[model samples]
Target: MNNLPVQWMAEQSQRGRHLCLILDSTAVPGIHQALLHQLTHEHYRSVYRETAVAALSVGGPFIFSIDSLNPSSLNELLEGQTRDWGWLASIENHSIAILVKHWRERLLIGKRPQQALYRFHDNRVLARALAHLPESAYPEYLGPVISACFWQGEQWATVDNPASGEYPVPDAAQWLATPAPVNQERAILLVNVGQYLLAEHSEDLARLPEALSPRAWLIAQLDLAQRWGWQTPEQLHFLVVERLRETHTPGIKNWEPRPEEHAQAHFERLRGERFPEVKTWR
Candidate 1:
C-alpha cells in the first residue's frame, strides 16, 4: 500500500488541519473502497455516515474526512463535474482553513477543550498550517480574516492601532483575498516550508534551508514581476512566501547561510530558553 497520501494527511491533521477529498463515483470506481480498506487495516478509526461520507480519525487532534459526493450533492455544491484536480484540492484545502480558523478563535476566547487531546501547547502551529495553505484554496469570506489572525498573530487584532504597521497585517489580509492559481505540488511545498519554520527540534531545523529554497526562487519571480510592472498570477504566492520568510528571518533576500543561524536562534528562543537580561524596556 502506498501510504504517501495517508501519511501526508496525517501530518496535516497533527498540525490541526483536516482534508476532505471528494472523488467522482463513476470515474473512480472502487478507489474510495480501496482507501477505506487501507485506512481500516491501518487501524485508523473510521466512521461511515449515511450520506456516503466517511470520516477517519488517526487518534489525532483533528479528523480527516473523505466524502464521495453523491450525484445531488456534487451537482448542487460543485456544479456537477470536477474540471480540475487542483480545483478539487482547493476545495478541500479551504475546508481545512475554515476549520482551523474556528478552532483558533475558540482557543483565543478562553474556551477550554472538552477532550485532553484537543489542547495544544502552541496554537501557532495550527495557525501556521492554515497560513501555509495556498491563497487559492481559501474561500472568499473566511480567507482574509483567518490569514491576518494566523500570520500577524496578536497584531491582527490591533489593526486599528497605528503601531501595528510593524506587522504586515493588512498586506497578509489583502494577499489572502486576492484570487490566484496554485497547484497541489506547490501547496505541498508551502506546507513543508511552514513545518520547517515552526519546527521546534534541531533535526527539523536542519531541513529549513532546503525547504525554503523553493520559496526564495518564488520570491525572486514576484520581485521581478513587480519591478517590471508585469501582471502575474503568482502575486499572492509571492506575498505569502515573502511575508513568512521575512517574519522568520528579517532583511534577508533569498535563502542563505546567515539567515539559517538567525532562524535557528529564533526557534531556540521560541523553544523556551533563559538568557541574561540585556536591556530594560523602561
Candidate 2:
C-alpha cells in the first residue's frame, strides 16, 4: 500500500479523476461476490462486458472505485492474490463503460484471421508493456488513463499518461488489426508463467538452486516440463527440485514418455529405486 503514494491520490482527486482499484476477477476468488459485500464507496465493472471476450465476463479484469477497499476486506482479497496485489491507476472523465471498452480493446492481438487474447489484468504484462512500449504507443496503450503507479521489481514505477483525455481517445481496434510492430509475445509468456509460479509454487521458487537464477531455471525447465506433461505448479515444483540443484549442476534424468502418475508418485518411484544423489544433487 505504501508503494501507492498518498500524494498522488490526493493530486488526482483534486484534478477530479476518480481513484480506482483495478483488480482482476481471475486473480481474486469470489471477487464479484466480494464486490457485492463492499460497495459502500462505489461499484465494479468488468472489462469483458462489451468486448470480444464477453463470454468471460465473470472471469475478467474489473475496475472498482478505491472507496470499496478497506483493511480487513483488502487483507481477505490479498490472501487469494498471493505475491501480486493489483495496483492503482486513475481515469479521467471517462465512464466505466468507456474504460472497459478501452481495456477490452487491448485484449485483442494478432491479425484478423488469427486473433488471440492475453491477460491484460496480468500486472507483469502491464509493467512490461508500459515500460517497453514506444512513446507513440503509450496513447494507444493507455487511452484516457491520467496516471498509473504500479509495482515494478523491488520498487514502484509510475507511467505518465501524456495523452490523458476527457473523452474516449483511442480506437485500440485501429492498432489491433495488425500486431504491434514490436512483438512482446515472448515477454508475455515469461511474465505469465513466472506469475503462475509466484502464485502456486513460491516455496519452490525460494528454494531454487544457486547455480541458476530463478528465471534461468524457469527457462531451462519450461519447455521440458510442458513437453513432459508437467503443467501444474506441483509438477513444476517436482521438476524444480529434481532438476535444479543447490550446490551442483542440475543432473535431471531425461525420462522417455511421461509416466502416467502424479509428479510425487513418479519421484517416489525413482527414489525408492535408490536414485543417485537425489538430496546431494538438489
- For 104-223, candidate 2 gives per-residue lDDT tens digits of 656655543233466666565667677667766676667767787665556656777788643443545333332432235544545545654554446667776566577886776767
- Misplaced by over 4 Å in model 2 are 1-3, 30-32, 40-42, 67-85, 111-114, 166-282
- Please, what is the TM-score per model? 0.19, 0.55
lDDT of 1 by residue, 172-225 (tens): 443233332354334433433333233322343344466556457445544544
lDDT agreement of model 2 with the native: 0.60
Quick one: best TM-score, which candidate?
A: 2
Lowest lDDT block of 10, candidate 1: 157-166
Q: What is the C-alpha lDDT of each candidate?
A: 0.32, 0.60
